[model samples]
Target chain A: MTLTPILAMRWWLPQDAALHGAALDREMYLALWIMTGLLATAHLVMLVGLCIGRREAKRSIWRLEVAPLLLLTILFGWMTIRAERLWAATRYAGADPAVMQVEVVGAQFVWYFRYPGADARFGKTKPELVQPGEGNPLGIDPGDEDGRDDRVSSELVLPIGREVDLRIRSLDVIHGFSVPEMRVKQNAIPGQVFHIHFTPVHEGRYAVLCTQVCGLGHYRMQAAVRVVSIAEFARWSER
Target chain B: MKIFSTHHRTIGIGYLLLAGTSVAIGTLLSLLMRVHRVWPDLNWPLWGVIKPEDYLAAVTMHGTLMVFFVLTTAPQSGFSNLVLPEQIGSRTMALPWLNAAGLWTTVASLLVLLSAFFVRGGGPISGWTSYPPLSALAEAGPGQATGMDLWLVSIGLFCIASTMNGANTLVTVIRCRCKGMTWGRMPLTVWAWLTAALLTVIVFSVLFAAALMLLCDWHAGTSFFVPAGGVINGVVDTQHGDGSPLLWLHLFWFFGHPEVYIAILPGMGMTSMLLANFCRRGIPAYRWMITTTLLIGLLGLSVWGHHMFVAGLNPWAGTVFQLTTIAIAIPSTAKVLNWLMTLWGSRPTYSTPMLWSLGFVSLFIAGGVTGPVLAQPALDAYLHNTFFVVAHFHLVMAMAGVFSIFAGLTYWFPLIAGRRLD
Candidate 1:
């Protein structure tokens, strides 16, 4: 039996479904345990001191102050290095060149996903041509040959086991694109394209939430991300 | 007219009362948001079926008021005015007129902020961080047009007021100390106010400039924060030229992170003073305590990028900020250790103020332990903008500030009101 569900019962974090998520969860748990132990010890010391009233003051400043502080410095220094390395594993390193590419666009209150069709390249988009009512929400330019085969969908469909590189941006304001199950969160800023890569290890559907408060519809701003078998994803993309 | 009196004590009481009212309204707004969040369909007589924009407006106003009017003012402007001069053996602040001016400007800023709700689109939904082009463009959202302008203007006025207050604190602490009250001999509370004032003088001015830049972007068609954006609300943003949203993040967080120190340092000082007094012993290693206080203030200004780690900040820059944030934890840890050491092995009085100090210590530790966790960019990747960040700040900054405020009120009630409340 896996310990993840049992851990989830008490950790209160969402189920980890991404490959990088387990390490992230491990780092988080380690930090939490260290902090919890320190917190309890500090409180216990305070309680003991308060109860043990009027004892002669010990002149050992080094024992009392310097040693503890030095220990904390070293401990936290180690944790910081570990956490930064883990974070850099995704952000500082580039994804494989052969990985799948998807353009994720965030509007006022919606999330739109686009796939580079047969051309395997995204079509150029213009802000002016964006009219969701006109059946073109991402504003695919008509003149660009790469634009013709681009497929736009409200939901994101991914093939399991493939590393997907997401080029995320917003049409208006700043919106946070967060999928908790994937342990992915990045701001979709206007005039900026942030590329984040992650691999899915599970085939279940997950909720894509807008973490940044966008507008009146922000609460309901969500989409579905369905991870499917490679064969199923191939058939779906072709359609 | 009485509220306009220039007496530092009266002005201090005015600040305390103002913060009291603000905390009331701010707490009510938060409660409304919380209830609405849990029961999205829950309807109240005053605010029926809270919309997302309404919820967001509450968020913006709640943060602005709690951070500025309550946390910033109560500890430094309110409690310090009541006790700072007395503790440092000064008859009055170095610049009384400036203190009075700061108070009046703050009052005006509060009025203007409240006026945003009555305007066309209600309060701006952008959070107190107020990252633009959401805060810059007029047609970005329901409250982006007129409401945001008022928000900027109000914040500008607050920046000016805080700058004035900081100046007065610095001048009083530096110049007005009575004879024989040397720097080392000065109370920790005075040192806290001095360092916090120094931070305020520097950072609030930067925030003022940032607010002005955003205002220009809004009406003057300047592209300070709004980039050559392709579109907002289906309208091509042609009026604005090249600008980066990251510029706003840099300027804002530059002020924003230090603003946290500005709010909490005075509380930390008060905790030190109270713990020593109630514990029937002086705080051990007073010099180190002062050094940590100043170190926290100094290091706070360098760690703003930690707020932007996942906001597209370069990975290398994020690592630098991560290191600085962890460095800050060293001083914070030493400070906590100092508090615990002071309380050790002494017959402590459990008076109301003592309880408040102890409570502040508890909250501070609970809130602070999470600092290193969130400071790491890896953890922040998933935790930034989440409720975890919210709880961290609330525990460490906001609620702890409130606790310190109460500690001051209980301890200094006789000084302010000529009678103890408890």
Candidate 2:
């Protein structure tokens, strides 16, 4: 009946660690507060109406009902526009060209992250060459010169304060690439690639979860996302 | 109880009983899921330690049963069969045999669906949405083979049953209303049933087509929903072509969004009538109530894209769906206000039916205010597929619809059984 446990543990939203997450958290809180207010007002009216009973007076339905509803509609319309602009700002706008590029591959129940290495150019991948047992999970072509320095890992490590554009795709079924702390979620579907970009503001370890139901192993389809200092990230990549 | 008999009350009671059984099983399935969620490692006598496949099977079956049998059937088919003719002053439904046929077919459909649990691979692991290549590829996983086929066939049968019943309701309302039972003169409940039946015919047909297409992809090597380059369980599927998963999303939600209204509109009508009856007066804004009901039905059809904002839909399309989805709030808000206004200043009895009606409104408001929040693509970007969505629909459609079902049963108890339920 109460959220005391949830509140005490501070488990809501899980310590946002991305630069854009604060604004998102603010937007979510604003919407929740507004919705709470609206719910309270409606319930209060219902309670009052039930208690006092109906007055048998001749009244214009327009003034008593339609006008207030119209006002509420306008308010909701404004809120929709505000939320739409926020979405366009985040999802529709292009990321900076110089933003760091990371390839995120989802297959079955595992996540694979690839860095372009010092060349800053991602190597080509072939679907037929995708043999996880052969140590080529992403099927990066061996003949591509740029692929010689490419690095692949099960963990996603990023440098703090650097905007990272994630090219997300799935080799098999559709998978959802989600990180709650970063306010990022996008479906990684086979035969297509989606680009989602964000900047991690704080250095911390967050959970990377597959939000879509890919198969039997969906529950365990998880990975770790570590945001570290630029020097630390360089050191880890070098290792 | 004769299978061929065309009695209206018998079929209605049959529908209600069927729904009751479904809700019972559906609730138990949900309880199993909740228990497993909190204590996932607790080994069971029957299933032992629950694997993810077992958990997903529960999810798929629980959703399928609740949505199809309980929510859709109980509100419109069950209650409407009992009351639509009587309220309109007709002897029985225009096509009573068709009505009985619909009920039994639904029973058979339920059996086919339940049989999936006992199949070799267990019930389908894909959620009720059944998004493919997971759903399309037989080698995708445990449930994707035979269990998935049973799911599709069951859904296909359900579509047929629903379409037949919807047509029967529409015909009875249109042709069988007794003298002077004009459209305006009909009770709000009749109007609600009428609109819901209209939606059923239009949307169920689309769903039938989708289910059949999925079945073909499963057996006939058709690729209506399967795309190329999909590897299932490490096996590459060369059978795929230009098919898209988004196409299925569009077709499914096209029926899926309005399906909620089909579940709720009758309840809205029942709530309005019950609120007025218990309050000892007609709904203050009866015309407005009808208008809002129709508006909800119309707007519900276009907002299916709201469910796909995070499913790779065009951002521009997302904007449009957002507008239409938000527009629904106006009518929905009006319906709630109409109930409150009717309750104002009228001392009403707080009996079982009235309490259920009140509960419907309370839950409706509690659940509905979150509509616009999820309607926004920006917010949904984070909240989609999260428990936020699960809670929102449970509050709005599932729980609210169940409350209305209870309200209808309690209100119509005496008329059908000739005695009040204890």
**Top-DockQ structure, candidate number:** 2
Q: A54-145 in candidate 2: lDDT tens per residue? A: 57786577886898898898889789878888888887876898889999999989999999999999998877777889898888899999
TM-score of each: 0.97, 0.97
| Best model number under lDDT | 1
lDDT for each residue of candidate 2 in B1-422, tens digit (9 for 90 to 100) = 56456888888889898999999999999999999989999989977998889989999999999999999999999999888899999999999889988999999999999999999989999999999888988777898888999999999999999999999999999999999999989999999999999999999999999999989888888888877867666666788786888788899999999999999999999999998999887777778888999999888888899988878766788899989999999999999878878887788998999999999999999999999899988899899998899999999889889999989889899976899888
Please provide, for model 1 over A1-239, each residue's C-alpha lDDT reduced to its tens digit, 9 standing for 90 to 100. Answer: 69887776755678888889999999989999999999999999999988885876465778899899999999998998898889888789878878899999999889999999988899999888888888998889999999899999999999998899999998877889999989999988888899899999999999999988777788889999999999999999888
Off by over 4 Å in 2: A1-7, B1-3
Clashes of 1: 0
Residue lDDT tens for model 1, B316-398: 99899999999999999999999999988888889998999999999999999999999989889889888789999999888
- The local lDDT score (0 to 100) that residue B221 gets in candidate 2 is 82
Interface RMSD of each: 1.2, 1.3
* Segments in model 1 whose C-alpha atoms lie over 4 Å from true places: A1-11
TM-score of chain B of each: 0.98, 0.98
Q: Model 1: DockQ against the native? A: 0.72
